[model samples]
Target chain A: MPMLDLISSTGVAPNDVEPALFDAAVNQDIDALHLPNDADLSDYLDALPRVKSIFVDFPAFTDGRGFSLARLLRHRHGYEGLLVADGQLIPDQFAFALQCGFDAVRVKRSERERHTAEAWQAALDAFDVTYQRGYAVKAGPATSIFDARLTAAEANKTTDPFSA
Target chain B: MYRYDEFDAEFVNARVAQFRDQVERRLDGRLSEAEFRPLRLMNGLYLQLHAYMLRVAVPYGTLRSEQLRMLAHLADKYDKGYGHVTTRQNMQFNWPVLGDVPDMLADLASVEMHAIQTSGNCIRNVTCDPYAGAAADEIEDPRPLAELLRQWSMLHPEFSFLPRKFKIAVTGAPTHDRAMVRAHDIGIEVVRGPSGEVGYHIIVGGGLGRTPIIGETLRAFCPKDELLPYLDATMRVYNRFGRRDNKYKARIKILVRETGIEEFRFLVDEEFKALDASDIMVSQAERDRIAAYFAPPEYASDIKALDLEAQPEAFRKWVETNVHTHVQPGYAIVNISLKDPERAPGDITAEQMRAVADLADKHSFGEIRTTHQQNMVLAHVRQDELRAVWDGLVAAQLEDANINLIGDIICCPGMDFCALATARSIPVAQKIAERFNDHARQQAIGEMQIKISGCINACGHHHVGHIGILGLEKAGVEFYQVTLGGDATQTARVGDRTGKGLSEAELIDGIERIVDRYMDVREGNERFLDTYQRLGAETFKEALYADA
Candidate 1:
């Protein structure tokens, strides 16, 4: 099973998919993944699908994109799958990665695993909702009648609607 | 004042509820700080230097007596008993805790006021002429149009996440009291067409910042009916093409500069077609309804007599200094100078707000105005009731008659309050006002503007004064630089820096030298600006250093 069918400018885009940027997103099977170095992990939530996941290459330890994307995919994206933090999965980001949402994290079975998992669990117990856009579904649009009226928009006002 | 209809009430109530839930979620560790910053900013709540600061849009700076009283109440209960009137024509409370902001917003919502989009990188509170409807020489009252823009721009989905904040100001007054028709992201001024029909001469990219620009004329005559769609189209264009990557080069003004006004105009026109397809006819009609709500209040037909010669010496001085003529018969514009002796300019206590509100209800229309000069204005007052209102104002410590004169200054809350400021503006303004509080001497000196800023970010409007002082820090010691003859009017221009910066002590000495030079060379009764213009900066510059 792979959420890898989804390709986006911001996320772990399938290398096999041909793509322009900004206005384009495509669905394809994931063989190899390429996460843009400069892309902010914030917009990557839109790239995650409910089904499958992929192995993210962490080019460097200082480059924390792999960890940030891992957390978003797991905790924020609610994707339950393997996230291999290859390349330079430094000791520190591994803990933060696990705290964010990464469940099955890859850091070569090393002496640091026991120490890192404790820190990750400790971090995970601290909070929730680590995003600007709401991830959890609320029952309805959060608003009221009066706010709705003022924001009733340009098309709704009988008089100058913009006067609100 | 536009009263909150049922629709408005419901919206605010719902927003409050939603925010309450958001707070709960945060407390329960369901939300993180970064996730919640934009949400809070959208609601007009900012985590400032210390506590939260809530800025409410006083759209066009007009307030009903009741609304002013409500603000007073909010100040008394939640803040340090006063509000700071910002240069952008919004009021800010600097010391509210995060938890209290929701309730403060609720109180504002009761009066059809809310802090929405007052902060975020979105369309900001629309500003207009303080005298709007009452001012002479207006093609039309600009407040209605301002209100219309406030409604139209709020929470615009596409434009909400702009690269930076946007400001729009409007003025119907040919004199440009609103500072409209200047460099803003969008500046609008009402103009008379060939048939005497009212049209708008829209200007775009006018602003005050690191790279200030005088707005270029975007359209010569935008007919009244097409104004809304044109504005919509303009925003759409900006939303689409405006820079988002680099915050510094994000304001529409910068884009306009980079692309050139002619190309920007073409892009805007193309976007305007898209807006036409949306066809917001209902909203256009809604403008009429909102306009109706703001129609001039019916007044007394009998004109009350104002005896110009029956004034005492002090009364004459006050009258000559503070009062302005009104378009309505026997009515006058009463200025409640916020810059009282030794008081922080523009700071009004909660008690003072209530007092002004009461005065407005009795002597003027039940309305109060917060001028761009950091003072409150009683826009429509009967001539006969002037004495009574003045007495009340005097008791409240707001009766200083220094409007547009020395010491009636515009000063930013510099290093003392604003984290962004480099030096203290309050001290500079206070010292200057103290030096010239002698009423007879000030009257002799005649009309002059002495503005101060804590930093180059001229929040105190130091750039547009007859005598401008910008406070800076030189090796941790406060220093001030002077700029003369900068006007913030139809012909807005930033003053050139005069000489090198001087220490705080020498700053006043320098100001005195310049003033003395004006007295010696000025033609009789010519104002400071007139003298400075006629004599040139070189003359003023020579005087400043002559006695140094």
Candidate 2:
């Protein structure tokens, strides 16, 4: 298995730390935590300070609960530790995962062979811009298209004519 | 009517290129069918029972003449020679080959139209009142807000892959909800604050399927600037806590029902307070810019009303049913009925599409709107020029005086084309239309909505029909269930089940008996839904099951 660093847009070796389940990690003295998509974030708030890395399971790429979990962990709980997405996800989801506060994705060896590293890198550069804000993109924070348009209008100080 | 600026055009073109690459990947075996299904669905290409179905979004049900012509071109060149208007105010081509969908999307993009987010688990196309700007009772035009939401929700990163599909509808009129706002996941009503500033009243968790629930008000009023953040917070909450174990219970309605609206609002408020929405909010200038596109067209002040006495009796009847009063003084809003009894409801031929485009160009400032009732509206026609418009429609075989009559049915492409359907809905709709083919009788029935869906998914919106019909497969045989008193207006409610299901042989007769019973028990000038509300479902149930 390999880990794809979406922020750096490169494939790297996976970390050797074995993450324990939420119960085990909280009860024992483990520093790494593994959470399911449906795991309650409030339950782990106390244990998050000591946790070094949190691995959120994406049972399938289409299952998007992991993205929300990543957002909650990053924005709501202020978890500054390494958050890794572990399971089956396509190259198309790499950009979304990166924007949703994921640090890296643990890809299965077979899945990597099928999709290839270059495909993942290309998927990252597929869209140069986005429509929503409050996301951590490679270029600092994401600026919404609406804000960009308003900035352009301010710089020009003139209205653009409507053309259909 | 909002035009794409450079950014919008570039984004749509880029998406078309991405889809083109994905299609190539699928064709060359780089992607499996399972992996390719969601990607294709996000771009609005569905593999149906017969062939591929491509749903092209008509954003907020508004279109330019050139856009409509481009749709006709796609129908002629890539698909079967016609298209189907869906219940959500989008267009669906029934028989397009899988290989040609990318080219079709490219064509759509050329005319500022694309099918992005028309399907998949993303926020589907944002719909609004078809008469948004032209309605006489509109407090504000809803299209600008609908357009803003459309752009905001397009290819959204965090909310794209939700538990299930999401829908949003908006209405500008306080008294009438032609947009069917309460039947969506998030229903927004344009409202005025005490200081005369415009805000939105947000309703969340309304939906129809196997389980139908009318949405409850999530926020009494959301300030215009905070709308995006509020919606973002709502989506975040639903994406995080909405049920995923059961596919059937994955909608936001189920989450709202399970968590209750009060708790859901609390969670949303917590999320909303944390969101930094300065960059996401629409500026007043930007809103004004969008609103300018929907401004009323210049009307001819010298235009005079048509003389009804000189026109034929048929034309007078058509005027009575199809023409609605426009806010502009000398202009009228005309509905072009797609429900000719000989054809399936909402199906329009390529030639008819071109004719509509021509009519729009000549009479309605080149603007057209697709209604949620599966009809097209020429939003601005001069009173004197209506006869000319009617002549063109008659020539195109599109002049069916059945705007809100019983003949104007809303039906989904059921077993004939859809893979998920249990029985055929189009033929059933056509048979009912034929049974009541008499124009005078249909007019006498008066403003009746008979919605039919082939399965529990309720694509036909059977749950909101005045007379609802749901078709199910029982022991490999098709049976239909009738529901009564569903309303889709401001006072929206899900229809109640009458009793047991009826066979195909007994369905039409049963419906006729119900209508006959309503006629027998009705007071002066009351519609079918009004009569049903006054008498209740018990009366209709007795009429339906007495012989059995």
RMSD of each: 9.2, 3.4
Poorest lDDT segment (10 consecutive residues) of candidate 2 chain B: B274-283
Give per-residue lDDT, candidate 1, residue B6: 65
B157-268: candidate 1 lDDT, tens digit per residue: 3355555788888998856555545857888898998898888989899776656577789998988878866876677567656776676788898889999999999988
Best by TM-score: 2
Whole-model lDDT per candidate: 0.70, 0.88
Q: Pick the candidate with the highest DockQ.
A: 2
- State the lDDT at B495 in candidate 2: 95
TM-score of 2: 0.95
DockQ (0 to 1) for model 2: 0.53
Give Cα distance to truth, residue B367, candidate 1, Å.
0.9
Candidate 2 segments whose C-alpha is farther than 4 A from its true place: A1-31, A46-51, A139-143, A158-164
**Per-residue alpha-carbon lDDT of model 2 for B112-177, expressed as tens digits?**
999999999989999999998999999999999999999889887788999999999999996999
